[model samples]
Target: MSTPPTSSGPQLRSFASTNRFLTEIASPSSLRPGYVLVGDEIFLYDRCRKAVLSTLVPEDFRDFSLHDLDLSETSIFEALDRAQTPSLMAPFQVLFIRNIKNLYGRGSKKEEFAAIEAYFRSPNPQALILFVADHIRIPTDVRRMDYQDKERFDRIRETLGEWCGTVELARVDENDAVRWIADTAESRSVRFDPDAARELADSLGADMMLISSEFEKLLLYVEGKNRVTLGDVETMVLAAKQRSLYELTDAISAKDRPRALALLHGLLNASDGGEDAAIGHLYMLARTFRQMLIILEKNVRDSRAIWQALWQGFRMPPFAAEDLIRQARRYKSRRELTRALRLVARADLELRSSPVNKVLVLERLVLDLCAEPKSSLYEPSMQFAIEM
Candidate 1:
């Protein structure tokens, strides 16, 4: 995430606002002297770095990948020393530090951090320091300038006062994701109707980098098209696991047992023999169903409310809200929903432990869940028994 270089010059601050980092960095007036970007999203960091450098050195400069830098061998002193170098051609040099979490080690890590603290005491004016601390906590000294807790977003405002500015990088919720898609589509001069963008966002989930790339692809594909439609998104966007899971739900809701079973089998086959990946998919599926069941029990009529509830718990694409509501309507009772979820959980366990035919096992589970009168929920079991 990046903010446009601030006109007031760069402000020393910490970014806590989730995925909107790009929007922040895009601001033409938010760049500062020393920037410590903390997050696990490498793509976000890379994009922010590019954006910032583009503004700082609009013409000529080499792109440096901090990941290539050996943090283990390079001491904090060495890093600062490198940052001290004058720009070969330009007035300023850009230093990109990737995987700042590596700066936190046990033995030598302590020394490195200490050196960093000392270096921060007197930052280089000629060099722009961009520290990418992907998911690692900044030291208290650095954080002291701008701290924000849920109850106190103004903590930074009050504490740092004029000394620094704090930008909170909150996780991109569904609404934000949708808005981002629309904005991105518009900026590319491509038409992204609400439904189409939502579809793409749902398919991409919270992976902004992938979402951005996919949006670009869609923009290119529909170059001359004035506005993108749902059909375009459906044809161009490949569904990620979350969307695929929702597809499975939709198939089950429609009593399309074959389709539901196919979806499950396809997911397993795509697992590449990784038990962890299969388990992770099932875990997400189970959690989604469980939440859907909860929403149904509440008898929530407002689709947006139901979606908001789910988004609070899971990173569902905003476009899937209606589908989830429709699927929720298919479950007449909490008992039936619970039963289906139990079957999913069992299938998850079987996938991990059972020596039996994995494909057959998953197929049976799907069929059972689609059984009518609950046949829609249990038919797979009967089919598996007969086939086996």
Candidate 2:
């Protein structure tokens, strides 16, 4: 997906380019006397706060509580009454509604829903009713009704559509993510080397919120630097716990016994305060390897499909899927991987039960599996290793 054009200044030109409704208001067109901003991005709320101050409304519109209108306690009449209120100063006022989806369902008071629908049918021209329902789908009636049947909803969409223009914000894919990170880092006056951007994208995955926060932190940490290097990213952005586990897995896969042992030791040191936490990390790593084996056995050829299966079944972090997909390519066949997985499973049990040093047990298991002949029996020994 294409990344939206980054605005150089504070003003934005289109809401269609962003999921944020408030950011759209910063566009010159949306600042008109009457406009309705709708959507479920938190940025929209911040926009409303700015708009309220600009309009100079009494009682500090910023203080308006989301809970003020109780769907159960407040009647539709009361809501409509509020929607119908005239602007305090300007020719038009905004009627902001947060969590509009809450107005749905049989549990909602009938009157409140009716009032909301009616206001949509004939929205006051002098009052702009902004609805923010982030992530929730628009109600069926609202979606299906013709303009005449749902005049207010139609009008709101039309107004927003016009102001937002033809641009629609698309989700950033891996390629776009790399570019976005680079651009964002540069815009903040922080150096974002190409390699650092790629590493950041791989680690953060598709979670935009986390990516943004990390970008900011990295920028601040590396302030005054001309370049954000891979080492900088490793130091500041990488999750130490996750990094060590991933490194341990890589070392095992590559048959690097010493490195694998070192990583295991690192994990142990990090978890010094709690032995259970260390065990849990090892369990998670074993579980990840087990899943990799399953995907291989299923002969899932498509990376995306494998990713979906992993996410649906195991709830792994999205970013990890790509790495797993890459790792899956190393196995010559599902059988080989399955055998290796069984070895790891045994290592898992040994760490838990065997009197051997947990780290030593894990290191030995890695070595043995990497040394195993490609033709070894697949299921029983593998299962035995895990069970024992």
Candidate 3:
């Protein structure tokens, strides 16, 4: 699922479930037996995680108090058993249960859910269980949530909602994300220029995590200046990400599979989110392909005409115009670009399915894009062209 690379700006939105969790974490007495963090937004998700850790698990008592369990490896029954049993080493117990989909998988799971109901009814007072359902990606606008995620959310609601508090970690809005950057920068005695913040957010697709990490780098880069400008953002953020991105596109267009994969790994390594940023990478790939499609369709020859051909938000950076135009021209026909987009779309669906080893999924995608199509087939309707 598409998620922000990392969390940004310490402050949460008024409507954020994470904010509510922070408030609730303050009064441990009123805490519920368990909470389900339902979303794949890493920034918001990390905030919730930190709140719980700081409140319940002390650094020294971590070994005794903290438990990171996966239902796939360890059964839910075993997890509840550990929760029910008191820890002599620590005063409180905090369990982070991942791979929660295992519970809702095949079989009626009546025995498992009944055990949950029984445990919650007479839950251990000294323990807290947090179910990380990171598989579901909740969008800023819930109406636009993908069909599969909606179904998963509904199923989880029907089952887990009966006993646990639901904390949705949805994507941050663009305006709010920009505000967060400004607020966070000010906290560190730095002035975040409005244009700079907006450009940074736009360039990275409002990914709070990426925005946050890259802003940190920008802060260090402009240590004495104490002010982040749009120029600094383009130099530090866009040059670092977009430049490498275009290079990756160039390699893919040339069918240089090794170079493309290497560039993909470099992009992933440079990112703080690593494999977690796979969706963001795929989003950019789909976007670049879409741009190439438009350039081809309009027969845009020069970099100057690209401005008129591609719309405002979809336009490539100034430095990448010529490179993008050249890359677009490398494609002999529109079908190739459309085929690339279709591959990206398929990879996107696979990522959303919560596959093991996300990096492998990305690597496979790069390999497919670099591979020549077996048949010179073309869709008359050109359905895949606009599918992205």
Query: Highest TM-score, which number?
Result: 3
TM for candidate 1 is: 0.53
Put down candidate 1 lDDT per residue, 1-388, tens digits, no spaces. 3322221111212222422444545554554555655444444455566666565555544543122344556655677787765555566666765545455434555565556556656656666666554443232233443343322334223322123223333334445556666765666566679987777766865555676677667777887875777766665565654677788888987889889888876565545454346656656667667767867987766655875556465645655667787888888887787777767766765776764666676677778778865455444442222221
- Evaluate all candidate structures by whole-model CA lDDT and list the values in order: 0.59, 0.55, 0.84
The CA lDDT at 209 in model 3 is: 74
Over 1-388, each residue of candidate 2 has an lDDT whose tens digit, in order, gives 2222242232322222343444545554454333333433333234355544454344445344211344345544665676577646455455544444445434735665555556656666555444443433222123443444245344445443343222222234555656667766667666788987787767766345455667767766787766777666666664534655776777777777788778777666656344445457656676767767766666656655876566565645555665665666667776666676676676566666754456566556667755745454454466543542
Runs with alpha carbons beyond 4 Å of true place in candidate 1? 1-31, 63-70, 87-90, 107-114, 137-170, 240-369, 372-388
lDDT of 2 at 203: 71
TM-scores for all candidates: the values are 0.53, 0.56, 0.64
Indicate the worst ten consecutive residues by lDDT in candidate 1.
4-13
Candidate 3 Cα misplacement greater than 4 A, ranges:
1-15, 239-388
As a whole number from 0 to 100, the lDDT of residue 283 in candidate 3 is 84
Instruction: Enumerate residue pairs that collide in model 2.
Output: 40-134, 120-152, 346-385
How many clashes (backbone atoms < 3 Å, residues ≥3 apart in a chain or on different chains) does model 3 have? 2
- Maximum-lDDT candidate: 3
| Total backbone clashes of candidate 1, pairs 3 or more residues apart or in separate chains | 43
lDDT of 1: 0.59
Better of 1 and 2 by lDDT: 1
Q: Which segments of candidate 2 are over 4 A away from where they belong?
A: 1-16, 19-61, 64-80, 87-95, 98-127, 136-170, 173-180, 223-227, 238-285, 296-313, 322-335, 345-388
